[model samples]
Target: MMRTFPFGTAALLMLFCSIVSGAWLGLHPAAQKQADLTFWTFTKIHYDPYTETIPTFEQQHHCKVDLQLVDTRAVTSRLQAAMLSDVDVPDLVEIPIDFAPAFFRGPLEHVGFIDLTQRIHQAGLWDKMVQARFAPYTSRGHIFGLPHDVHPVQLAYRSDIFAQEGVDVSKIKTWDDFIRIGRKLTIPNKRYMLELYDFRSAHLEACMFQRGGGYFDPQGHCIFDNDIGVQTMLWFVPLVAGPHKIAGSIGSGQILTQAVEDGYFLCLVCPDWRSKSIEKDIPRMAGKMKLMPLPAVTANSRHTSTWGGTMLGITRHCKNPDLAWQLALHLYLNKKELGKRYEGTNILPALRAAWSEPSFSQPRPYWCNQPIGALYAKLAPDVPFQYTSPFIATAKDKLGEALVACVQYYNANGDNGFEPFVRATLKEKADQVRALAARNPY
Candidate 1:
């Protein structure tokens, strides 16, 4: 009775059951898992724009995104640690120009960021973007990140104060003319012509860039003691110290805003982003400020400089690089998205195609209806190229030290032998930088 069923029949029965199961499973397939991506930015303002726009990317790609807002110092530290440990890393990150050099310290193949040069060219974006803006994110001829903005610097002056003092800023084409007119407006501690922090090198760096001078040459060699560097430092020291002082330290935060309100400073070195900050921080300054091209070192020199900058790059650990690259293109190259960001940040897009957005040409009441965006766009093409290196920050700090020393020398010795002293001081600083570079050859 137990052997009653034939062997062939039993085998056929089992095969039929397996076929049925396979067909049924094919009709009701398992759900596909959704992809996940994480993004990190150092500033909340930078994070907000992506938050508003990333939903579109998620819907199209059928993925989820997690956005993080980390502080500047923490962002740098966490990124470095993650790169070293290969754990808990974001797929995409926003790197400030000041922090970009550190990531480039390693050999090309070992760099944390993906090499995007071929992708950029393949996407036809290499020619679509402002070519000079890529300098900060490039290393050894390999591009790693897409530039975030063209931070062209200009002169933001209190138009009301300038008019009241009968100073014609239009004639101020060169630094000499600026100083001549500034002398009449400068009143020592009461009111100063402009702001130049003696202890900080930002303003000085901008001026040097304007004259096509910087901490390092294109070959990544230290050139802080070159002719252009020496000339800029000599001209800059007298304005912040000695008898020719026409600049003052206006501090920051409430102190800066209060100084603007109290007319403690007449002019400021305004980059594109700083204009927006001025709008938000000092609301009462609306319609009272006007922008002009920065006075050049010479009539033939560039009239504009650059200040802060940022870039977005895909990390080497990204699980979905294709998706990340698409997202970057959406955030940086799409005119509508860039327009939305510019409305809040007043940053000029590095993508040349986005410059034609109406938002850029719109006259805002905050800046005396000056079409602030248009003004910056005119200078964007001329913004100088800034080279990056691991020693750039250190070189800048050394220049700051040299500035302090030169100021001290001017204060005690006046203008006598000032050039020689500055030359010697900068040479000594340059030598120190060379020594450090030798110890850490990259």
Candidate 2:
């Protein structure tokens, strides 16, 4: 028999002790010489340009930065606990786009994060940043964090496969066009036009985002089950389950990579990270792969949306906010540092100024000489900016549940009952999220 502690008890206890120990070191005023900053991060970047810049930053400021890498799933809970306990808080940390909403639920001052508005204005960085990327980290007219990467969404397709199937990629200007082309390309159990298994809710979210539908409206009300949302689902369900059957279910992780390599799906709606992974994993796809702006809901609609990203933030508990801000500014605003990070990870930089670097416009031999970075740079600004609410985490979980339920129902009963079932379930989930948000815990 094994006993389990609550989610972050052990980690929080250790962090609290570390903070207490550090405080003890400050008992003598004469012993305090320079400030020490702790930085926590989830993704372990072995060759981070930010890490390289730290030596020079420390030399100039006479400070030391301790970079701590932790499990990705534990970050949000740990940060919340540190805020409540007021101990062992990191001076700097990275927060994912989706998680940013949850952290921004309340007043910025109460959230244990320093407001970066004045600092940004002082640095004259307003025009230098990707303006659209600012929305996710802003709440109630307060800016809490700085963007790290731009994850613009696009359609990655197999040009060879589409041509072989007698489908013209350029004719796919809308979802209807995609459906038409997809129907022709799908070969029952043999191949498909798109992947539907692991990314079902994500696909729906992308479509919703593209059509200007989000989990909440600007006033922080749940509107994910609006007319536009229902319309998107009605249009989306058939592609996955009906006679059009354009999508095939693929498992997560290695199975997905294997499916793509074997040509099980001709196209996938993805962001910058996935596109990069494809080039790295299947180098043989050289001239066969091509990227296009995501097919619009209508010919006149917007062409693209965003998917995943992260931002850097400074904690209010930091002993040296000035030094922490300096370090963060260096990491995000330094063109040389951002360019290096982009080269190593293929993560599209959130600094708008970085798009003009010569490297960003270069063609990739792995992508049929496509200027992948340049294309994403063009799409980045077009991504619709939307508000994310504190209840986004809850809404995300409920939306996923609804998606899974609807997918199973559609597979079992076919198209006859899908539209109504999906509509009703999604509406119910949206209502639940609205109720949660109305409580005003913030």
TM-scores of the candidates are: 0.91, 0.87
Q: What are the per-residue Cα lDDT tens digits for candidate 1 across 50-131? A: 8899999889888888888988888889999999999888899998998987887778888899999999999888788888
- Against the true structure, whose lDDT is highest? 1
Across 1-442, the per-residue lDDT of candidate 2 in tens digits comes to: 1135455677767877999988987774554324498887777652255577778778988878887776667878999888889877889988877777777766556766788888887887667777777777777767788888878888899888877778777888998888787887788888998986533467778778899887777667788888877777766666787555899677766777778778998888878877877777767778888998898887788888888778788998888898899988877877777766776666788788888877777888777788788888898878877678888878878777777777677778887777788789889999898788878865
In TM-score terms, candidate 1 sits at: 0.91
Off by over 4 Å in 2: 1-35, 45-47, 197-200, 408-420
Model 1 misplaced stretches (Cα beyond 4 Å): 1-35
With candidate 1 superimposed using the best TM-score fit, by how many Å does residue 298's alpha carbon deviate from the native? 1.5
The true-versus-predicted C-alpha distance at residue 308 of model 1, in Å, is 1.0
N/CA/C clash count, model 1: 0
Candidate 2, residue 135: Cα displacement in angstroms equals 1.1
